[model samples]
Every structure is written in structure tokens, then in C-alpha cells.
Target: MSGPPAAPVSGLRALPAPDDGWKMLLRKEVLRFWRVAFQTIAAPVLTAVLYLLIFGHVLEGRVQVYPGVGYVAFLVPGLVMMSVLQNAFANSASSLVQSKIMGNLVFQLLTPLSSWNWFVAYVGAAVARGLLVGLGVYLVTLLYAPPRAAAPLWVLAFALLGAGMMAVLGLLAGLWADKFDQMAMFQNFIVMPMTFLAGVFYSIHTLPGIWQALSHLNPFFYMIDGFRHGFFGASDVSPWLSLAVAGGSFALLSALALHLLKTGYKLRN
Candidate 1:
């Protein structure tokens, strides 16, 4: 005697594929920022514009990082890349911390999604927001002084790699931080200081010998330097070197973030 007949496959709804999990999470994360574009998107663009106007006006004639490139023109790419890195970091870091504080992260934990899904979804959303803000800054700054992209490919490459690296770093920060102040400390003391020192407003070559060497040690320097190279086709270091440093930093951070996610560090607690 057989048990009750098996349910008809056609009558039952199919479960979503594994890939769908990440996709749905990605969509949610993306919407989270897009819905608050006024704050997440517009505010950053305006801040970048203010930087351009203030610095470009004061230093336009006095400071020239690259020959034949005006100071305002030289400043545009740096500002754009800076916006990209900061916002990318903010997106994932804030999302994770907020979810944890509001007690919604458990909902995600209850899903069948793996650690990789969380990383991809969070990082992907970050990259989206970063690129969008970067694009906005670039466009608005163009109104001040148009920076040429002699190697547009380099601009695209470094933007993607830099944004990805920062996103992963932000994810790591998020996983480690139990509260908002910790995240703020990470950003304020670490991310913000590094970005400001990364040749955003001046060339490393102009620095004294010791400072120049110190600048070279900063990974954020490579990102801004390489991105500026795309504009002027000139840089303090070879773009190849910048690419290696940025790429390697990204890989290392990604591994650490994945390991933390797998262990559910601070997340499961």
C-alpha cells in the first residue's frame, strides 16, 4: 500500500534558483540607495562641486600637476575618483550596520544565501552607487573645466577596481563593527585621511622626497594617480604599477571579507 499520492509537480510552485537569491538582495540594496538619491547621490555631487570651485579657483594658475593640463582640469578626475571610493565604502558599511542595529540582518541570515551571496550583493550595490556618484561628479565638474581622457580605458579600469576594493573594505568594516560609531571611526580615521592624502589636490612629485616616498606607500594614492593618468596620460608612477597595487589590495581585502562572512563574525552574534 503506497502512501498518499505525491503532489503533482505542475501544481506546485518552483523554488527560485540559487542565483535568484543574490539577485533579489542586490536589487534591494540598490533600491535602498536609489530611493534616497537626494542624500546618497545629490549631496556627494554638490560637495565635489564645492571642492572644485574652491580649490580650482584658488590654485588654478599657481598649481599645475601636469604640463599643458590646467589645475581645474587636473582636479576633476581626482574628485570624481574620490567620490567613487568614498560612496562605495559608505554603501555596504552603512547597510550592514543599519540592518544589524534594526535587527533585520537575521532575516537575511535565515535565507539559503551563502556568504558569497552576501558579499556579491553588498559589493555589487556599492559599485553601482559608486559609479553613479562618480558619473554625477564628473559631469558637473566638466562645467568648470573639462578634463581630457587620453586613455579612457584606464579611467574605466581603475574606477571599477578602486570601487570594488573600497566596497570589500567597507564590507569588512561592516562585519567587524557592532555599532554606528565604530563604523564612523573606521571611515573618519582610516578611509577619509587616506583619501585626502592620496594626491587628490596635488601631485606627489611636488612633495618633498620623504613625503613622496610616503605617498607611494598609500594604496589610495595609486587609485587616484592611475585614474588621473587616464585624463592626462601622465602620472607620477607607471599605470602598470598602480594597477598591480590596487588590484592586489582589492584581492587581499576580498579574501578577508569572504572569510569573515563565512565565519559569521559579529554577524551571527
Candidate 2:
């Protein structure tokens, strides 16, 4: 043999392949929303502002859900949380459904990334969008009627839990939906009705006994109610109970989403 196999190049030694698919996915997801900031973030914030102006003006002094708390003030946190939950879910669900429909998702499937990587990237993007939207709503609302935070931690806890729950649900919806119509059905019929009936603009205590019982069955109620507790230090239910409900719902949805991802339900199938 003339010589040992050529030595590795001096300045270009063999290197291991990089595992950066997760990074790429995350960057793409983030940039996807960032590039259209107005649509991803601003429009939602504006919609929230409109809700505040319209609702606050109309119901300002007429309604007082919590003792000594202005109606507008009482409404702000709930609205902020509501905006967060919806946008978070929308971000992931729309992205996944669009990618699948457009046949672009195949590129991702070709990567070496694991299913866990896919789950993390999508859910992370959704949570980021949700938090940003929630913060946007909060800052904008400060101009109209500032909210009080008796238990700031409780507020954050519920916000994070709600966002996490919705993000996972979005992922599941995206994976389960074969078309945009199905995703739309989920949002319009289920998410929309639940958010509206969750008492974001009012208190459940004012509802009829049967309605109150029904509201308790909605997990969204726990999220909004628990978040409200952070502001007013009071709620229709104990914050602990709210936390339990929100946390449990989040766990359930997350498990479902992860399962769908692992099984490649509508994705690879």
C-alpha cells in the first residue's frame, strides 16, 4: 500500500453532522409570525383594544362584577387571557394545517428530527405568540382602565397554563385536520363558544344556577376565573380549584397532542 489512507485534511477534519432541525423549525416558526407582525400580533391586539373600548364604554359603571372593582378593570385581565389563549391556538393550528395542505410538511418529515422535536417547536411557537399577544393586550388596556394585581403570581400561573393548554390543542387540531375547513370548524364551534361563555366579560355568579353549573364544566372558565383572581384577589371559585382545573386540562391536551404527533395521525398517514 503506497501510504496510509490519506490523512484527514489539515484544516478540514471530519466532523459529525449537526442536529439542528429543531433550531431550524423554531426559527422558521418564529420568523413566520415575525415577518407578518401586524397580522400575527398587531391585528389581535387591535381587536382586543376594540373590545375594551366598546365593552368598557358601554358597561363601565353599569356593571360591577367584583365589589369595589370597576367593570372595565375587571374585564381587562379576562380579555387579555382570552386573547392569549386564542392567538396561541391559532398560531400552531393554522401553521400546521397550512403546511399539511400545501404539502410543505413533507420537508419536515424528511429531517432527522424526532417527534418530540416537532412537538416542542410547534408548541413553543404557539406559546410565544400567545404570551406576546397577552402582553400586548395588557399594555394597551392600561390606557383605558388599569387592572389591579392582588396576586401577581396567580395571574402569571393562569396565563401560562392557559397558553400551554391552547397551544397543545392547536397542535392536535392541526394534526387531526385534513383541511382548513375542519380546523375552522373546531375554532368557530368549540373554541369560540367556550371562550365567549367562559365569562371573560362578566362573572359567572350572575348566571342562573343551571348556567353556572354548566359554566363550571368548561375548562376555559377555570383559566379566566383563575386569572381574574390574580387581579381582584377574588373569583367565582377558589384560585386553588381553578389552578387544579387549568393544570389538569393542560396536561390532558398536551398528552393528546404529543400522542398524535408520535402516531403521525393525519400527518404521515
Candidate 3:
């Protein structure tokens, strides 16, 4: 009587909408790193603490980057920001490359998710991992020296911008790379060098004029400098300038990453 029982609904199911699709992918990515908390989260925190102990021991009372700020205190913020940047990049890049190598990336490709969905899910996961590692390092380093936040808003702003920038950069690296070795090269030759040269352990003001000029060229320098500014209310450059450079760099990288994803550059293959 009711049209033969509504034709016995089809066996096939509809694909998830963009909103729901991204949330599921994001949950999967978060769980991927959460399942290995020791390696993904704890390991980085330990490394930052080691850096603090070694550098803070040797440099404390010997050098002070800003007036009235101890070397250890100054070092804490740098370590936190460094951990944030590195872990963010590692999360997205490693996940993508590993999935590609394991032949599991095709599962993601088969989803009805759009490029925007992929970007938000992957970058969101990276940001989560990055902030978590940063917080862990900050809390642990407090045992050694507590860095005060003179401008808490600036600190939060730079931290978010820096994490977002590195996450997008990692997405680009993942897309361009085909194997682990290539990924290693990108990390070692590019990311590590930039972070180290970005005035993490020392201030650029101590460098020669030429070197200081070079330091200004590094975007990582702006990130760390701006973050350090939040603690001491002083920086090599204006915090607003750092905000502009960091914000602009993040935008450019995000646009490139989105373009690659939309075009299926290396992902479809």
C-alpha cells in the first residue's frame, strides 16, 4: 500500500558532507599522534629540557640577552617556540609521507573530502601537536627558570601564527616529497638550519652588523624574536613588524599548499 514499502531503501550510503568529513579526518590525524604520545609528545619535551639544562647551565649568569632577564629565562621562550615549530612541521610531514609509503594515502583520496577539508584537518592536527609540545616544554622548563609574559596577547598571537606557518610548510614538504629520504633532506637541510640560525640560543644583537642583517632575512628569526618579546617586552625588531612578516609568510605558504592540494599535485599519484 505504501509504494511497496518505499522500494526497500538502497544499500549504498551517501558520502559525508565537507564539515563532517574534515572532523573525522582531523580526529584520525590527532589519534595517530596521540597513540604514540611518548615519541610524538614526550620525546620533544625531553629534548627541549636537555637543551635548557645544558645551555642554561653554561650560559646562565654569563650572558643576558635582555636587561634584567637571565640567560635561562630568555632561553626558555626560545626553546618553547622552537619545539612548537619543529613538532608542527614533523607532525604533518611525517604523517603524509608515511601514509604514502604505506600505500594508505589512497584511502584518504577515496573520501568525498575537498582540498579545503584536507588542509583544515591536516593543519589543525599539526597546530594541536605543536601547541601541546610547546606547552610541555614550557611547563618542564619552569623547573629551571620561569619566563614572564609582559604581553600575553603578543605571545599567544605569535605562537599561533608560527605554528600555523610551520604546519603549512610541512604540508608543502609532504606533497613534494616521495620518500623518507627526501623528507629527511627537507628537515635536515632546511628546517633545522633555519631554526638554529634564528637566534634560539643567542640574540642576533650579539652578532656582527652583517650577521644581524642576515638574521633579519630569516622568517624564523621574526617568530622567535616576537615570541621572546612577549616575555621581556623587548625584541630585535618591532613586534608589529614580526607579526606582519609572520602573518604574510603564513598566508603565502597556505595559498601554495591549498593550490597544490586542489590540483592534486603529487597526492593523486
Candidate 4:
């Protein structure tokens, strides 16, 4: 009898042609919110709109920020940025923590994809959601308080940078947190307080001297201040300094996120 034919090689099949796992993961993350547009997208937009309506009504005539810029108009960009930053972070941190809690993360860890791929997929998806949410808030707010673009480039730059920074921070939070409570603590205890104190509702200059100096220490203030400058052509500080702080924070968080993934700090566990 003829000997058995040679067995086919296995576990080394040219890596299956390097499938588009990253793209697929990205698409899946995008679709995750799209499928539930009401919760993920509409809710935030509506919330921001409500804030515009309530505060705009109360403060519109009573307060004025920059010369020639109405209070409502002044508030729009800050709200938009706030919504973007918060939701962008929520997207990634929630996704990661949920995956870990539900035991779905193991499926991701089992894949041949590298840490960089994971980083791109998750962060890209978070940024995309953030931009979409920011756009939505802007469009809705226009109905109540239309604002002129004093520096469109600044608007674009700060929006992208703020969203990216928060996205990276979300990644780090997700990697570090073992549960939703911990993530919530990160958001409520840290992110929320910082954003609220960042002059989202008022000018930092209006605060007392001590508060004004304290505001400078909060990086979120620079983000909001810089974004507001985009609408008024004026700000309390240099736009360049804001850019440096926001960009620097993003770089630091990004490096930390990559390092965590590479070292399998919490992700591998």
C-alpha cells in the first residue's frame, strides 16, 4: 500500500493573508453606537441642547461675554467641546470596562492582532463618535443660539485635540479600571469636576483672583478657553499655550496607553 500522503502544514498558513481585523473592529465599534443611535448620539445632543436652552434663556440677556458676542453664542462652542470630550471618553472607557466585565475581552486578546492595532481601532472609533456628537450638538444648538466662527482653524484644532486627548485617557482608564464603579469614579471625581470648573458656563476671568489662578492649573480650562477663542477671537490666555498643553496631554496619554497594552498591564490580565 502506498504511504499516506504528506500532511498539510498547520498553524503557519501565511498568517491568513493579514486580514482586516483592525478595520473590522473599527467598523464594529462605529456600528455599535449607530445601532443604538438614540442612546449614544441623540441623548448627548439633546442634553446639550437642553443646557443651551435653559442657560441661554436665563443668561442670554443677563450676561454677555466677549464684545459683540451674545451669551448664547458664547456658550455654544464650550458646550459642544464639553459634550465631545465627555462622550469620547465614555465611549472608550465604557467599551473596555464592559468588555472586561462581560468576559468578551478575552476574544479580543485571543486574536493575532497587535497592541497598536487595538489602539488604533479603539481610539479611532472613540474620536469618530466624539466628532459626530460634537457636530450634532453644534447643529442643534444653532437652532437656539447661532454663533459665528471667529477662528475656524482654532475651533477645528481644539475640537480634534480635545477629543483625541480624552480618547487616549479613556483608553488608559479602561485598561486601569477593573469595574464600572472605578471608571465612574474617574469620570465623576476627576473628569466631571475638571470640566465643570474649566469655565464651561462662565469666563474664568470673572472668577476671583485665587480661582482664576487655580483655573490655570486645570488643563481642561485651557481646552475650553482655547475653543472659546475660536468663537470670540479673544481668550484669557495664549492659544499657543493651550495647544501645547492639550497636545502634550494627548501625547503623554497615548504613550501610556500603548505602553500598557504592550506590557499587558491590565489588558492581558
| All candidates: TM-score | 0.93, 0.91, 0.93, 0.91
**Candidate 2: RMSD to truth:** 7.0
Worst 10 residues of 2 by lDDT: 8-17
Question: Candidate 3 — which residues are off by over 4 angstroms?
Answer: 1-19
Candidate 2: tens digits of C-alpha lDDT, residues 1-269: 48678653222112222587787898899888989999999999999999889998999999988789998898899899999999999999999999988999878776766667887789898989999999999998999886588999998999899999999999988988889999999999999999999999889989999999999999999999999899889999999999999999988887777666666677764
Question: What is the C-alpha local distance difference test score of each model?
Answer: 0.91, 0.88, 0.91, 0.87
Candidate no. 1 TM-score: 0.93
What tens digits encode model 3's per-residue C-alpha lDDT throughout 1-269?
44555443121123335459789999999999999999999999999999999988888999977888999999999999999999999999999999999999988877778778888899999999999999999999888886598999999999999999999999999999999999999999999999999999999989999999999999999999999999899998999999999999999999988878877788767
Note the clash tally of each candidate. Answer: 0, 0, 0, 0
* Clashes by residue pair, model 1: none
Please give the lDDT score for candidate 2.
Answer: 0.88
lDDT of 4 by residue, 117-193 (tens): 78888899899999999999998887876667889999999999999999889989998899999999999999999
- Output the TM-score of candidate 4: 0.91
**lDDT tens digits, residue span 1-269, model 1:** 87998864221122333657889999999999999999999999999999999999999899877778889998899999999999999999999999999999988877877777888899999999999999999998878886588999999999999999999999988988889999999999999999999999999888999999899889999999999999889999999999999999999999888877766788867
35 Cα displacement, candidate 2 (Å): 0.8
